[model samples]
Target: MTEQVPVTSEMATPRRRKVFTIGAALIVLLLLLAAGTTFLWSRWTHSISNDAFVDAYLINVSPQVAGDIVEVYVREQQRVEAGQLLALIDPTPYQREVALLEAARDVATAALEKSKSELAFLEEDVPLAIAISERRLQIARDRLAEMESALLMVTRDVENGVRAASFQVEAAKAAVVLSEEDYVRYGALYEDRSATERRFEVATKSFEQARAQLEASRARLGQAEAQRQRVPITEHQRDAARGAVEEAERQVEVARLRRIEVDVKRRAVVEHRRKVTEAERAIELAATEVEYTRIVAPYDGIIARKWRHLGDYAQRGEPLFSMYDPDFVFVTCHLGEDKLDGVAPGNRVSIQLEAYGEPFEGRVLWLGSATGANFSLLPRDLSSGEFTYVIQRVPTRILVDRDERWPLLIPGLSATVRIDHGPGDPQWVEEGLRWEDRAAHLSERARD
Candidate 1:
């Protein structure tokens, strides 16, 4: 091929050494530049923390009622929607309780209705009976008044008749006495021929008539005296009427007492109504228990673990499954305190997960108020004056932006986050622009 030239060892060594020295100097220069750039980029633009991991809200699903598990409808790592059925407990006992309480409620309600009807009837009937008794009492009083008035009239009539009969008897007696004297005188005159036979006969006939009139007057007086007996009879009738009025008043009092019975019945109705209400409450509680038998998901999530199985007995408040919402995931970073000077909420971030090669876009969510060491189980005590100053890290949260590759991020994954708090182009962008310019220059020289 090419022409070959022979050289001495010293000349060859110096030339080789110069080439080697230039190569080493170029490498050293490159390394120093890279180091300086990295230092400047980190100090001026961003804060980095490797102590970061993905976090989410983990929920443990539990049952609210105790029973035997009748069915299990999910498994570990299964995706579920809100209100999806997870499992079922035995509902027969709860159903039976509800049915029993419902029947009791119906019975109590019926009893309440009966009591109400009885109260209504009494409300109408009792007042009517009282009115009837009062009416009877009024009628009896009126009758007594009539009887007393009649008795007074009869007594007056009897007294007047007796007085008139006595006067008539006295007049009749005088007439009899005078007539007898006249008859005797006429008889003597007839014997002495001073009077005729007709005169004597007239005197005797006059005496007979006067005597009969006296007997008739005496019979009238006796009849008038008998009329006094009617007074006692009228008094007896009036007394009987007064007794009737008293009896009617007693009946009215008895009827009014029946109102107490109505009050008692009303109380019974109230008691029955209370029983019905209690039974209804029991039924409602039982129905709620029955609904508790069906275990449904509270939100859309993925089941992380299944703690119970079919036919297993689960107590109240026992864990049935553990799940988490993947859509609400974020990263928690423990950043050194000195590096948080420019870091703040809403700053841009780049996250690199250990499981993936590409970086994810994120934004600063919030910063923790206390360092991680403050939440330790046994925090170091500094009051004893024996202390070593150590750098503390503050917990910071970064919200990852959702993308097509979001599903690959899981909780507890280790990640390295770079939080950009500066307001200019990043170091990588400037370096890329410089390299592009150099490449263009080289291309132009080649073309020339």
Candidate 2:
């Protein structure tokens, strides 16, 4: 058997102390590993960003029409409601314009009515007058026909009277010749003592009677010729009747022309009515301009800025005031691209307003597709020689619950936000999160 070595208490104590020191080092290392694991887990469960601010929709109130401001109703930072009168422009000019337009429209309406009445009168009376003229023309034509027939009958009577008078003249001439022959023969016989004185006297008396009869026949012929010449007078009367018919026809044509003129007047009345309508529209436009002289609030909000005052001249599209709704306030944060890996809308978030000194709860409402710098008025050029790669931050919108306590929290307030990336309570996350929860969290932090 090997020689047994003698052991000392000091050596044994040293060995025991070495084992104890190693055991203590191992325990410390295990504790450090556990702490590192916990820290990493916490980091993985939370996404934090300091680049955020309270934001709201800002409205730039401007005038719809140009005018001098007569009254300003609110001061800077004053609260107002929807439809509240914020300012008033000088409405005297617009009012006067509306009045003038109204008067003009009334005048136009009266003119249109007059034209319509005139047209109606023409419509009613013109046709009747034309009918009467046509009837007159027909009567004139019939008169002409009667006169012409009378002229033909007079002409035939004149011809017959002329023939009868010529036959009487020829018979009287034969009797006168016979009487002269008898008178001469009786005178010769008496001279020869072959006839008596009584016989001779009878022959002379016969010759004288024949001469008187011849004179009567010639007078009758002259009278008959005068009657034949009178036939031309009947022809003259027929011509006069023809002229009357032509005149009547002209009158009828004039009546027809008057009817056409009436139709033209009807068209003129239509045009006047259109003018009246245009005047009415002009009056409406003037009224609208008058109404535009008053500026009213569009929604409930506090005035953030006042750009105009009493006596200020406001122009269209010029800002008179600036305002934002307090109840609609939210946080706009720039989330780093690396932090958006698992982030999405509806993520639970905690907001800490530097002004409020409290944490407020909110939920992600929207996520942007582009970086903030990309939307800047002047974006950085990546191709420049001094270009350096920069991490882009995406803009994220978070909706906060309305809280009466934080009524002063408006746009542009500094804030920090932390979003929970771990499994969240569906009831609180899905249904809604209260900003009051942030007040409670503040209380808890204060207690701690």
Best by TM-score: 1
For all predictions, the C-alpha RMSD in Å is: 12.2, 8.6
| Model 1 Cα lDDT, one tens digit per residue, 230-268 | 999999999999999999999999999999999999999
The parts of candidate 2 lying over 4 Å away from their true place are: 1-39, 168-220, 380-387, 403-408, 422-448
In angstroms, the error of model 1 at 216 is 3.9
Q: What TM-score, over all chains together, does every model reach?
A: 0.79, 0.76
Error of 2 at 186 (Å): 9.9
lDDT of 2 by residue, 187-246 (tens): 999889899999999999999999999999999888888997778899899999999999
Clashes of 2: 0
